[model samples]
Target: MQTRTALSLVAIAALTACASQPMRAPFSQADLPAAVQVPAGHTVVMETAAAGDITYQCRAKKDMAGQFEWVFVGPDAGLKDRSGKVIGKYYGPPATWENNDGSKVTATQLAVAPNGAANIPLQLVKANPAMGMGAMQGVSYIQRVATVSGIAPASTCAKANEGANQLVRYTADYIFYKAM
Candidate 1:
């Protein structure tokens, strides 16, 4: 009977220690490009994986008459937690991140660094004041990394296809940070 009680105590102590450990961040900023790294004085508050499409349209290149290329229109993605549960969405012309609770933030691009020729660039954005009072309440910065295949279509973008829209699927991890 005494042995059983001692074993129970040990098990409880182990569980307590585990519960006190801090949650590990999903990704390390050191592995990311400097231009896309979150600034100091901020701590990660949320991390989500975004999976969706980027819309691009064929348009005449500015100041380069007779030349046409694909221009980024915007993104439409579902933001999911590590377990793949749908939590929010990211979309826009104005570049918005919205939680299911109706809280949202619009942000301006701060910097971008190349990921690869076949992938879209990794980016950093400064979030504007959030609109509601949920998960985005104090978000200061958002980093878009781990990008996969959001590049423009490889097809010809001649004048014949002007205004044609193409959707390129992509997956990326968006890490949200707040002032510490």
Candidate 2:
């Protein structure tokens, strides 16, 4: 019947429209803590889900003899796209993000807010000028949000444990933005 064919065409057209539109980001800055929110005039250029471990070492607390604590060493993570394909890596003492194209960026911490008692804090960082080119070019800011379980070990850090290292598992969403 003509009516049935018309309805089928309408459905096909609707699906085509949706397929052609760019995908929207899964995150919303308005729902995030203010300290970690990216400033206006920037638009998301890339978003990645990072999974890996943070290394910490037990060391004497600064300015406080006879006390010890866990100090952050660095992070090592594989960055994945929304559908779970590894696109890059995140690592370093200098905190670097590198894409498959060999482009990279190192950023300075701007601010942080508590995520939860059992998780690492959400963070915002101002990106330094990118190195190389490709995906990292023009990146202005990077926000670490939706953190899970990156906190330092809760075990006692005593003189006996000095210099001992621990690797804590964590996952987070790293969203990179560029000036619009």
Best by lDDT: 2
Q: Once superposed on the true structure, which residue ranges of model 2 sit more than 4 Å away at CA?
A: 1-26
Cα lDDT of model 2 by residue, 66-127, tens digit: 99999999999999977789999999989999999999999999999999999999999999
Per-residue accuracy of model 1 over 106-135 as CA lDDT, tens digit each: 999999999999999999999999999999
TM-scores of the models, in the order given: 0.86, 0.87
Candidate 1 deviant stretches above 4 angstroms: 1-26
RMSD vs true structure, all candidates: 4.8, 5.4
Candidate 1: which pairs clash?
Answer: none
Residue 76 miss distance in model 1 (angstroms):
0.4
Candidate 2, clashing residue pairs?
Answer: none
